[model samples]
Target chain A: MDTISDTLGRFGGVYLLPLALGAVAFILMGAPSSWVTLTIAGLAMGMMVFLMASGLSLVFGLMDVLNFGHSAFISFGAFVAASILAGLSGWLEGGWFLASAALALALLGSIAFGLAAGLFFETVIIRPVYRDHLRQILITMGALIVSEQLILAIWGGTPFTVARPTFLEGAWIIGDVSIEIYRVFAFVLGLSVFVGLMLLLNRTRIGLLIRAGVENREMVESLGFKINRLFIGVFMLGSALAALGGAMWAGYETLITPALGGEMMIVVFIVVIIGGLGSIEGTLLGAIIVGLTANYVGFLAPKLALASNMILMMAILMWRPSGLKPAVK
Target chain B: MNVLLSIRDMKTSIGQYHVLHGVTFDVREGGVFVLLGRNGAGKTTTLRSIMGLWQPSPASITFKGQNIAGMTTADIARLGIAYVPENMGIFGGLTVQENLILATTKGRFDQIRLRRIYELFPALEQFWSKQAWALSGGQKQMLAVARAIIEPRDLILVDEPTKGLAPSIVAAMGEAFREIALTTTILLVEQNFNFARSLGRDMAVIDDGHVVHRGTMADFAADSDLQGKLLGLSA
Candidate 1:
């Protein structure tokens, strides 16, 4: 009995708590179908949120600059992918080969767009406003408005459909349940990206410099590294990641509209705040928890979907002011 | 001694608050030059200005006979100068080994250099795998110094090394700085008069951003009146 108590005391409140809650949710809502199907959906949505939140959290962690314009980058990527994929039918007829080719183009195009936007924001807007928080907020908010308007002008007000490739069509059956291939594809893409990003940060000199910058930007600058160049690099990388998620979501959801970004802005912030500021792992865990909770609640009581996320965040904040895993002192 | 870095009438302002008022000092090549002052007297500011952390007014600085007044910190650092800020400024998340790796940009990991640094401070080798935050205050200070010296630099600027450290660590830091001064020109800002005097070199007393006194450590030690006037505390 003592050993049982000790084990619970040791790891119960850690990630185990969240895992248990998520499992219970799976068993309840997605029961008749294999819990694994619901789990996969939960995991994919969780990673999608993670992909979006990690970059946002990193920028906030390093620069202390709250970027409200981040959602715009995500929406922009989705719109870009949808428009390119939608337009490809005019130039090429067959679906699979053309879809594959168009996806490749969309990936490259969105990254380029994101990189340019990041570089431009760093130089023209963010650099000057580093000294003033109020000015930064106002300027970035203005930029956000401009981006949203640009999205509307380019893609129009109509919701555009993002067609799934023929290869990703139908569902994979495991036991009594069936899982859509598109969600699984999104899960693979998101997790693969998360893994790739982890490698980039851990196994590179640039990553070391970035970690240093997170601790002390002044020290990094004084250590013979071009601060401007590093800042630009980080911003562009962050923007590109956000854009990739956007593009993937567009394909996964089969629709892209400008308002999608504005709607997601609040949820992204909630994930970042609960994930412990600047921690990559915290972001991942927080994103998954939030995703599964929202998904399950939306399944159970459709009216309580949004409120459930808000309540979960509020509970975490009330309990842990510094977040689940605060910055190491 | 030859002059390696010269600060001539350097003036700087941190967000409209003028901290350095035309401070001028020369760091002689291969010498331990200490800037002595009380808190808020702008000694740290002088070191920062020289490192190009703060852009002092143009036409007031030169390094190795070249104008460096408007250069960025990174550009100045590339010219073989390193700075250790007021706070140790060690990245808390990184291990000691990773910190050392990040400091090495020359592409030669230089095992000999690492061994030499370890020889100077053996405490580092034991804590190589530990995150910097987990180390004691003294270890962090040693790690900061080790980081600056592991890579080659013509001159190194250290601000308040002995601050918030044990007396034993301060003594060890003094000896380490002494050994490093043999290879690199050092311009250090120190408030600990005993530690500064123990270093045994030229000393500049900065009061309100002006160099009011510049002489040997012995000369300053002999004159209590000047020390009191400049430092505002009896030694």
Candidate 2:
């Protein structure tokens, strides 16, 4: 018990920073007495990071492809979901079942949009740049510009709003803490997707094949595994997950715009770098750390949210060049 | 006898420096065919070209009598040719059991055959649950070989099996190869002359991206001078 207390004492301040910031946010934001609301908010953002970081880390870790245009997919997904919500101006909150159906449609629609976007990016832009780092950077940068322009042209620079279901709009109060329903729903949704992704990667045969691809892509191909198809599948999945995150962000902020994706992309990169590339578990840990850091730092100075991630990434890299997890196979 | 794999005048270039310069070989049905060469002699490149990991100079590569040159590696693999690379490439993160399961993609889970494989390398059974990265060099080689033979294939291309392995493990590996050769066709690339000689089927000595000598291993073993001139070492 003494040892436990000593250990806790050493690490106790670290934990309290986030809790204290959250407590302050609960009071200052005038979000009446539900600490759970802020907890759910943290969880939601953490999950959003999970969806983006997992794909970024996987591709960067396994394929050695530093996808500079990953944010373009996120922006594209948000625009797609927002457009759908815009189209559904009249029908979002009819009932729980219909609201759920709308959300599902948006989710799947965003996934399909992600797939098409990924396919075009990989086949047209990224394929020619394989194993060429400089060319990959140049081409993907061009892709990022082109995608950003496309989003601007289609959705414009203005933010778009999507309605929340009536069931998910209110708040639940528990003693000193009042929690928002949408944030709770978003947290559950994020965790469920994370768990599902883990199962897909760990428990399936294709997962083994994918892991093999991560370790040695050429060998996987040499072993009679279709490496091109694997690359496409990985690219598609990564984009879909990123888009899913974008969709969730659209719901949380109740507003979607092309700008948010580019903003979030920087944080995603920091998470991938700090958590270690190619490790699913590492990405999860990294996401939570970055989420909490942003929340904690944002409480003191809202602008530090951006700088803190960069500082954290630099610190982790200075201590360990290969990121938190060594990517050597 | 049916021809399992044939490479004719294949040339492969990686970034302006050509690796395979008009190299050619053939593997007839059911025997251990060896690709012998000194270091950097394009022996591994030849195997990779056949498996489509490298682009072969357009030529007739007929496996099971169908032209397969220039095909994708995975498609060629699905056509029943398994490649074991020079570095003993087993998925390091996966366990021996998981590795075997992943390799056996036809849904043919042969526990008895797997047990037989474990019997060949008892150390493997002992470390079945351990991640393959933690395995010793010999155990990794055994796992690589086991992964190759787990799924049924018409031809298996093994690159440098006995490299960097202990003597006892090499002996065990030799025995395993002998057992595999009883029912399967193998095309091997080896610098270990004695190990290649022990297989005693047929040998092709490659030098500087070309096959310099092709004959029965018995004849090559008998001729020490030819071995010295081609491989720079006689065993």
Tens-digit lDDT track of model 1 for B100-163: 7777785356898899888888989999999899989899999888889888899888999999
Candidate 2 residue lDDT tens string, B1-235: 7767777888889878998777777788888999898899999888888888888887558888788887898898888888788898888988888877777766457887887787888887899899999999988999999888887788889999999999999999999989888888999999888899998598798888888888888899999898889888744
Worst 10 residues of 2 chain A by lDDT: A13-22
**Model 1 misplaced regions, further than 4 Å:** A1-14, A24-35, A90-98, A325-328
Which residue runs of candidate 2 sit more than 4 Å off their true CA positions?
A1-40, A93-95, A300-303, A325-329, B1-3
